[model samples]
Target: MTQVQTLDRTGTDAVAKAWTHVRGNLRRSAGQRLFDQWLKPVVLVDGSTESAVRLGLPSSFMTQWVKNHYSERLLLEFRAVLPEVVSVTLETLSDEPQRVLKAEVEAPAMVPPPASAERPSFDPRFSFQRFVVDSTNRVAFNAAKAMAMPGVPQFSPLYLHAGTGQGKTHLMHAIGQTFLAANPGATAIYVTGERFMFEFVQALRSRDTHAFKTRLRSVDLLMIDDLQFIGGKDATQEEFFHTVNEFMSAGKRLVIAADRAPQALEGFEPRLAGRLGSGLVADIRPAELELRRAIVARKLEDMPAVDMPAEVVDLLAARITANVRELEGALNRLVAYANLSNETITVDFAVNTLGEVLRSAQRRITIDEIQRAVSSHFELKQLDLISERRAVAIARPRQIAMYLAKRLTTRSLPEIGRKFGGRDHSTVIHAVRRIEDLRAKDVEIDGAVRALMRTLEG
Candidate 1:
């Protein structure tokens, strides 16, 4: 073979070996679902040169995502295999068939692509400036801002936990972006708990464990979101604990997000949970009606031309309480539908378009809210309703609260009983039964209970 041909063959052989290791590592690093969906479809192209390797993905979207999220790691992996390698890029594969043996990828655990003049790792929409802060999430919002600001990290390993779409991940992203802006050139790594576990496992499989540790620890800031995924994962948790210790010891800041507070992370290592709680633990409560309304208005502001009726805005804000993400989605769907129809949006239109969302949102109400609503409707203090007062004035409202708590909220009998001044499950059952019979026989009691139900439901 000529020298050029010989060089090509050598490069091809190195890449082939690199691909085998990279693929295995990537499979472990990215979960099987992500690997199969995004990475697995990528094929090494025929025109791939030695210094600049090209990975061809199935679609433009996949190509862009891989380039954004995985290109840095791929470049590092390629350099390890071929010392002369300088760049790794992802391109959309052609529909026509090609020779199939090129399955390997130059793979390392993803180092997020270098940030552009504009933030790269974080979604522009998820910045602190755009986040709609209200009483529900103000503490978490402030804590996140503090973590992002330059200076001593007031709280290392700051843990922010909340239900889905309540902005926990958004806070992490904001912290990362702000941290980078405050301390330019500082390294920040943002990953999910599943991704962390996958990458650690991949490193172990590929015997690249040291590189994994170095890559993770070398970072100045590490943010892990959705940590509940690694709860019972022993080995992953072991590596995570060590990573946490090393970062804390070095005074590097860590930001973590989960679905529950540290104490509620039942299966997680107790020590790890305790360590997470050692830093600031901020809870983001479910957004209230006023906040939800404000979010709807802000979402509408994004499309200034779109006409969202006052009633429709009120409908969405009042109905969609599950999370800001879902709330946003419902609005998006409504606007898209409205534009398609070229008609005015109405409460009726919104109800029809988002009937399922409205139903789901209804289920978001808490037992506390139910109790408060019943107490308010009867013009009795909330404490009187839950206290041991046996007077008809308090007892009637108390029974109605218990009835609504059972009927509306998903709390169990025992749980609902505990909320009502330590009453037993039997008392809750009796209250529910008494209310049901009263609704049938007594007109005044029936009207009052029905009014309370309508008030709470609305």
Candidate 2:
């Protein structure tokens, strides 16, 4: 019997050594379904650290699938068998495969790239010019534009808050693109809070946290979407706080977006909430009928041939009053239906196609539901949250609940006041003012109110 060497020597010695034994194990395990589908596609591009291995995947779908289903298992196996890989990252392979792989191999040795320097993959269709300004989000849109002007510090971290499908993400990207255009060399990064957390965890596991910090802190502008998801993670929050401080101290811009206000982010640390609230916070209210109609018209500009009746558009604008995402979805469905049926888009056809979504949007939220959410968030009895107690804690929370009820529901001041221990309507007015003042002046108070609002809205 002749013995044969299985591994090939390569110019990148580190990568070769790291994969010498792992490739054999993987080959043996290839029969497994998951190993074939998720793991087999990932090729080790380089080993920058003794504990971190870079992997290249063919597509984003495969990268996400592997990350979602098998990242931990892959990491564990690599760590146990290779003894060199502390973590494994699945990066999408670029069209220029060799160039991307070379960059990955050399990245660890070079100074970490600036966070803002990483150009975001923004959708050109979503720009300030294209976004229809209406009563619902005009203030937010104007504020974002003002903040985007070169050398302006009107709001360091403009927090855009609203329910999902509202154009918060669109606004953030628009600001980034606008800022870059104004300041040619200006750097900006657009990442979801979830991506921030994911990158932070990856850094921690690989013991390359210093590089991560350097990259993030070097950014001139950092925009985080869906920041409410940053709740419940102590380590990530700590890292984020320092990053925020560094950027703010250096007069760099930070923009964050969330489905609800800062106070509504349960499980988030108080200090993190305070930092987030320390700048201008604007809420993008749900779209009104006119705004929805404008959005439909603007979207239809791209598909002029797919015409719909005025009544159909009016019905959609009036009936499907959800967020912009739903609005776009309805239009997409109508266009597709028309193309398939070879029929002109009509009011009846639009109604039948989008009946379910329209009906769902019309679902009503009650004052009672708001009261219960408020009570739970404040850790008080349902009656306590609504009672006219003058104690600082109870009174403030009660006022916030009343404010939410007034703003979110169609309840009259007198009706809301009656629900809250039959207090006078004037009391409701006072509570609303108090909360509004606090929101404008006190960061902590603003965060708390926002958090409570999210609970109620949910």
Candidate 3:
């Protein structure tokens, strides 16, 4: 008994340090909102002299939720911090005599048997800290941060839209997580479009419509993702419409995200569509090359021991231009293979490992896009660069943008000139030539051009 007690004490300290490291990473990886909800209650239950580790949660529900979504990553983080550790387990901690036996034996029988939840779950990995912000996503990111502030949100029903994998879901999750952290005990629910539909249908079928409505509307924070799918569901829409009104009317924070803007959602009721746009509407543009590189760096921060070559990361950032999710997946695949097989991830290895992803992610930049990129960089409107204004702010940026268009896109000088408010081909040539000369001479312009090039190319 003495030896067992001593071992437990020693193991507790070791596990505490390990869990601290793991928790930080988990909070960063999962998102603050989710970590607070699901993981904040967890503590070490299996602190033994053996290599295996176990975690105890307050309920079987939390245990199973983390097990399904975070088991692999949790184990990875554990092993990363404690090389001696080989296994990680999660069990419910409760006063029941059976609960003690359950943690000591296998798991809580209460773990939901389903592979996926019918309801959306908050992931701690989706917090604002984990979100890689840049020119493309800055507006949306800022808007999300603002909405997450304490007290009634200055804006209600913040609407975020982006193409798939572009962090619409991330922001939605981030807002919920951040808002919850600021206001503890705040009831926040995250529901996906399909999951919300299924849950609503089940409620109607089970004759539990009142309970469902009460549960969904009672939350202080309600976040709905992928609002585009709510289009075809007339019944669901009616309920969801009321849910929105309930939240808004009560001054509860409500955030809705979709692939398209409210107006662009086909078949959406006119009133609902109008209501969606009544609040802040922030759009996440496609990620820039620099942003992708930064995201890749952020993703690989978890694998400090992995000898991920710079060229390989650059290759992934440059090639995997689809969205953040796919980019992270590609990085994860390469890192996992390298870590498991003890092989260094090189440029060649990355190329071979992610051929299919690269093919699908191939996106060519256009001259118009170049103009937009340059205009965005200079904080000037796209029209400012194209207009006949000869101010230094407009003309210099115009020339630099033309130079970028000539270099980045395969557009002819005449075509490029036509793009820049229909100037002659010689004007485009002079602009390109003059900018080329200035790039070497003017440090500011040179820096601007180089930064723009990296943004476009990467």
Q: CA lDDT of each candidate?
A: 0.77, 0.72, 0.75
Stretches of candidate 2 above 4 Å error?
1-116, 364-458
The TM-score values for the models, in the order shown, are 0.62, 0.59, 0.60
Q: After TM-score superposition, what is the CA distance of residue 421 in candidate 1 from its true location, in Å?
A: 32
User: What digit string (tens of lDDT, one per residue) describes model 1 on residues 55-91?
Assistant: 7776788888788778876775566566677787777
lDDT of 3 by residue, 1-458 (tens): 00111225544566556666666655543334445677767666644433787777777888888787667666767776677777888777765442221122112222322211122235667889999887788889999999888876888889999998999987887787787677775666676777688767867886878757766776677788888887889999998889888878888788899988999999899899998899889999877666888998887786677777765766777667778888989888888777777777786777677778876776677888888889899999999988999998899999998887765554678999998899999998899889979977898988898688767766
Give me candidate 2's TM-score against the actual structure. 0.59
Q: List residue ranges in candidate 1 displaced over 4 A.
A: 1-120, 363-458
Sort every candidate by TM-score, greatest first. 1, 3, 2
lDDT of 3: 0.75
* Leading candidate by lDDT: 1
How much RMSD separates candidate 1 from the native structure?
Answer: 13.6
Candidate 2, clashing residue pairs? 51-86, 263-447, 263-451, 264-450, 264-451
Residue 37, model 2: Cα distance from true site in angstroms: 17
